[model samples]
Target: MSLSLVLTLLGAIFLLLLFRYILTPLFLSPLAHIPAAHPTSVFTPLWISYHRRGGSQALPAITRAHSLYGPIIRLGPHELSVRSQSAIHKVYIEKGGFAKPKFWADEFMSYGVRNMVSMQGGIGSKEHAGRKRDLGNVYAKSVLLGSGVLSDVAARVLRGMDEVLERIVGEEDNADAEKTGSGVMEVYNFNGAVNADIASSYIYGTDGRTNFVGDVAKRNEYFEHHGTWLKGKHGHAESQKWLEEFGVQLCGPGVSALRDEEKGGADAVVYKQLHARGLRGNDMASETLDHFIAGAEAPRTTLTYLQWELSRNPTRQARLRTELRTLPLDPTTDIPNLKALDALPFLDAVLMETLRLYTPTPGPQHRITPPEGTTIHGIFIPGSTRISASLAILHHNAEVFPEPGVWRPERWGGGDKERESLEEMRKWFWVFSKGSRGCIGKDFTVIVMKLIVAKMYSKYETEVMEDGNMEQEDKFLAGPVGERLVLRFRAVK
Candidate 1:
């Protein structure tokens, strides 16, 4: 009961607490055996979170960690990043045990409603599967390539191309020569406009679609507002409300047109599918709004990068145009056959290479471990551990992709000798991710990108006008940091 006796007991308890909380996790835990991205990573997530805050710092730092430590590295006390083919199969492919973290829900929820992207575990998983099933058919590769879907998509894309051409080459007689004639066009803005126009056509039907592609003033307004809202220039609450109202406005016409007894247009593909499965009101609107959002962003990033890359390399552009010339043209529309376009070897090579280098969703596709736990690269990860694999890292594996930073499409053009290397590269390609929960809109995005690229290159030769600050932004769906890609177009003649 003396004061000295009390002090000795207090020191004993403090040492026990330190050993249990800090020392054990730092040295004795199974996760400690894995390579740490930073000295504090074994006990705290602060290091990783600090780097990942904003701007494009996390990617380079993580890439360096993988280089120093091999395939799997501990990003935090409970977070692991693996960049191996085996990890991809086990985490994303082998069944669906690794569920998405709430990050998707927090970032992707539309109209304050959960769609597939925002759905987590529990009944949410089942609901997501049902929603995917309802809308699967329209986005299927076969359906997208079919005459019916292709014709509708082609009409929309080509109409957008007309606006682009008019903007670039100008009309013969116009009061405003500046708006009409050959000059620098912002590829990023035009890319979003066309993608939005095409995606909405399929979502709501052609009759209810936005004419952003055809109407230059309207497209400028939409993109400008989006930029301002994203920067939080106006208050967050006000910006979010404006976004919600925009979603409603975007969806209203399609919903009304679909209900019409004498609706005479291409099928409201997504709406019909969802209605058939019994979703109505905000439920239907959330799913459609998410689709419109998806349609607008990632594809636009891909197209922008594709144009930027091709514009910088004239020989590649010449080669691509030569390949495009071989496509069989449709007698009626003058557009090439969609199937033939997909088959062009050089065109496919160009696209595959662009996706490899500038993956839009280059950030980690995060997944949490099962309750049972699992081993990755010989290191045992505990249950409910946070795990992820970044396309930015995997796609840059120098072994799979020699000179990983270089933009070389010929790497994808595997002849007899490079077949083995080509197969290895494909195994590491996670641009869309893989498995049951992979991107449902892959086919739609791919076909649309091909249509736009093929049509643009065939008619005009592009040269870079301004490409400063072209480093891609560091976010889930990343674009250029400056969000600008200006290019000058000259008619092929």
Candidate 2:
């Protein structure tokens, strides 16, 4: 063929490629009807990817997009961010839930194995349901309330609180002070230690639990690795390995015999359930490791922010203490009954408000549309498109939560009054999310956090000594900026 003929063919092919790859996605596709977060989002994921990389400003940018573009907006060429309740139901509940995106596996898988959180697709969903069934009874609200597991967990939390009190009092005594607790304590790390201990004990029983609360050196060593693994800091590979090995050791031979005496030699609930389900060796270990991962950091984040809020408002803190004191203490243990502690209206309000305002895992949970596709909020999202809903965005809806940024526990109405408003707010609440894929550890998290808060505020009034950079970081497991919450816990007279 002549050179001119070849040149003409090449130009034609180039135009066809442009139409297929760029023009179709940007202008001809159904997703083009949705508003783009950035102009580049119409044809590429580059804009949102840049924001999400290294935990950069994704949440803020998405929030702004939702505010400007209504409830549904295009996040990338094939990705969408949804905020309406009806859309959430359609995606998460209507058809047995959408498959999780690859990000869940890439980010959450532990010990080179998939747990429920990291699992994906039809097979993964079946396995997840099976696992949930195996462990459902133990995590049930009634069982958790009645069992020795939570009782032992509560006792352990109190012991941790004792150490905190001692540290504060000891430092003050050394400084020749007369009043109790004039010394500053970094609570974020301590809270992490306390949460880890609680989670391990509950999962493996007291015998396999780490005594991080009593052992500062051990807590520091563990947190150093854990924080490194979580944040992708330098040396993260080694840190990740160290964490996995630590989990493996806890699941070694004969570790299953570790039992709680209070339960009349009942084996550790989770380990027993996993063993009965025929998960042995690394499988069992990896499953337990996932529980540890789930249990530790989020509660720490909750407690840290809860205390920060309480410290900033002394009147509300005082009111919480009064409500806490109303619970009749167990004469022997000197701690309130787990069920009664859970029933405190004011305490529930404060916790609910904190969860609403400063949810730890407030980032988007990415899900993929089914192969056949479906409509979300009247918009027909195409098959296999990436879509997500954020707990942070839903929790901050101004219509549901008036003055959304303010810390007003009363907005929850202490569980009785404002019935209509409270119902509306609850519909928007997604802290633990909803539907079959919801958090399996919801009861565990709430009970442990309540126990810790009940124990702390009952005896001490916290005051912020130095809470610099308390703004919560915008990440999957959001925590306070600066990773420090210094406060002085004054003894309540």
Candidate 3:
């Protein structure tokens, strides 16, 4: 056959298969019994994919579908959304048979490189679990609380805040002759500095640290470079094809350039130190690096939101500051040793409330059912079906959280009813997710948040700058939609 004839035949075959396998099922199959976000959902995955690509709107759209369809909504011929908490636990925690959905693996895994967070399938799961087991002891609460990690992070945060304050004070002094109203100073970059510093320290240890706070220019450059890769647009087609064939090892040129740059820079020094401390090779070093980089973004964004919340509610901020003041304040001191700080009920309440109201990355935890049929939310679901549960929808359920959208930390305290409500919330708190696939760095994240918030409140007064936006983009992870935040800081003696 002529080449042109062969090409024409191939195109015809592709169209036929696309209509038969993709179009008919999405539109006309039995699974179509389930409601779709749009009329075209029955015929195409494009509706959902477009929203997913839109970033933050993805979860809200899924929640809207669940609201209309109830706990189980048929999304595609093979896909379903489970909105109930019971269903979430049943599908994700109890039925150990499901594997991560292909969409996540395709988007997240680096050139077929399977870290625990992005690994899929039975074989991948086993490999990831084994790696996690080896690293579990290091991340335990006792170790996190004891290793002085939080204290060191707190110190770095304080240092960064001091620098901001000094610069503000200097400006105020210099501008005394031109005297403006209130000498405002915006601190747009501190949260990012604190998280990047804290997260890097934990992963690489203090002796082998990167000055995320001190090296603003380099850090910003790294973020811009990495942002392109995260969008999956920098050589995405080539990377995905390579991943499909070779797995994670086939690092695309862009990714390879990044790895090479880091390996030659100060980050490489930290990687070496980690190896010297008996951690070696790609699994430990690579996974730690990926976690540190990805993890820093959300918590920093969360802290910025928390600070904004505190600023808006000055009375609450004052209460937290009062609580913070009662704790010991020696620069050499560790917070865990300060029982008063550790026991601050309102602070804890505020943190929990922030977590619920703004779940970082409120997207669904996607999974594929086992070969054997399973029951979720008491309904039977067949194997090979795609299923997911959204944290945002679950957290906002009015039944569990009264006045769900309001920020009410007091509700976390009151009495038995309040305590019970809080307990239930904790159970359904999919912030760090649940089960074996849960975030391995949960403890580290918590420590970082607590330390940063405590230190900031302890040493300075914060107010929201006019440009700050608490609204987050609901992508795979929630972050400031435009990746921008600004706040004013004034030193308090």
Candidate 4:
């Protein structure tokens, strides 16, 4: 053939390739039927990745996109952001066809091995299920409230809080003069320490307990290292090394802490079950580390906001104290029965309201569509597509939560419609996500949350002194934007 003829044929082939690769994905593909977050999202990831790196702005940005574009929106060439109830139910519940995205392994495998939270591949799911089944009773609502193991841990925490109270009220003689005996206590650190101590207690037993509440400085340093590891600011490996060192500290020399062959703490309780049913060493450590890693930041974020809200409302604080007094725990020393605390109407309202307003992990809970494809809200999402639903978006949904931004505990108490209202709220209450992969520690976390709230508000009246960065952070595991809260505690008369 002549050179001119060859050039003409080449040009025609290039045109065909453009139509197949670009034009089809932009205008003809199944995802093309859905609204695009940005026009380029039809064929590229630039739009979504840009926003993902947009920091805290990412939540409001995606939230606005759903508000403007309806429930299903294409965020990338292969990514779908679904917010509709029908879509959420299909992707996360009824169909349950989507698997966690690939990043979960890298995100959670920091403990030198993968735990159930990071489990992947074929048998990995079964392995996770097996771990949950074997250990499920340990965190069950009935068992947790009744378990001597948790009760002992709670008793320890309550005792620690009592000490913390003394320092907060300037009653302790050896209290760090600079750190305590003042009304202005950094409860951000206090909450974190309490959570860390409890988590460590369960993971490492009473002997290896971390007394963060007792020593605020130690918790400050521990969490500083912990946060560095999470944000990967300096570098992930360096930060992770620090965290792993801390992990070893939590588990070392305490496997037999509750000796006499009467091991009762979680370290012994879970280890025995896991070993008898097959699993040891790193497997044991990974799960324990999962608890440490998963449990720490949640309570920190939660208590800060709950206190912030209460500080803004003095009457609510007084009423909450009245409700807490009904628990019957001695204001100075005694611990309340967990069951009675859970049954408190006002305490339940405060916790449920906080979680709804400030869902801890408000970022995307992502899942990939199955090989056979799936339909969300009547829109057919092709197989192998990346899809997700944001709890932040779901929680603020106007229809489900009227005046979504307002913090009104009364909304949770609807008398005759109380059961009906709570059932409806649960549908929109995506703080912990839903479906098979829902947080196993939801009840566990709630128990701890209610317990602490019950204990703290029972005697102390908190005043928010300096709450500069009160905004919630924009990361996957986020707290207030300020990341700090300074408050004054006055003993309730």
Among the numbered candidates, top lDDT falls to: 2
- Best-first order by lDDT: 2, 1, 4, 3
| Candidate 1 residue-wise lDDT, 1-493, digit = tens | 9999999999989999888779988888889899898888888899998997743337777888889998899999889888888887888888654787876455667667888777765223676677778786888888888757556666656765765576556644332123424655677878888888888878877766777776778777677666555444455556557666777776677667667626554556887678778887777888887788788888888899999999989998998998888787777766777778788877888888899999988878888888778888777888888888888899898888989998888888712244337777888888988886788888888888888888788988988878878898776667888898878778886
Clashing pairs in 1: none
In model 3, residue pairs whose N, Cα or C atoms come closer than 3 Å (at least 3 residues apart or on different chains), thus clashing, are: 26-42, 27-42, 56-474, 111-247, 111-248, 112-247, 112-248, 113-248, 361-478
* C-alpha local distance difference test of each model: 0.78, 0.81, 0.64, 0.76
Best by TM-score: 2
Q: What is the C-alpha RMSD of each candidate to the true structure, in Å?
A: 2.8, 2.8, 7.5, 2.8
**Model 2 per-residue lDDT tens digits across residues 1-493:** 9999999999999999899878998778988789999988987899999998885549999999999999999999989999998889987877568888877656777778877788774323677788777775777888888877678666866776676686675574432222434556778878887788888877776677777777777778887898788777789999989999999876652264543343466646787777777887877888888888778888888898899999999989998998898898777666778889888888999999999999988989888998888887777788889888999999999998988999899888775565338889989999998887888888888988888898889888888877779888877788887788888877777
Please, what are the lDDT tens digits per residue for candidate 3 over residues 1-493?
Answer: 9999999999999999998977776655656456676676666677787777734347877888888878788665567888776777767677453688777765665434555677775423666566665565666767656655456555765576556556664565432112332425433344666677666655554534456566667556545545545555566465335323321221122233335555552322233333444543454444555666655676766776787788788888888888777777654643435334545777788887888888876888888887776776555667888888888888888888888898887777722244536677777677878877777777767766776678778777767656445577776667665565455566677
Which of the two, 3 or 4, has more TM-score? 4
Off by over 4 Å in 1: 5-13, 55-57, 121-124, 171-181, 225-237, 260-264, 414-420
TM-score of structure candidate 4: 0.92
Model 1 is weakest, by summed lDDT over 10 consecutive residues, at 172-181
Model 4 lowest lDDT segment of ten: 172-181
**Count of backbone clashes for each model?**
0, 0, 9, 2
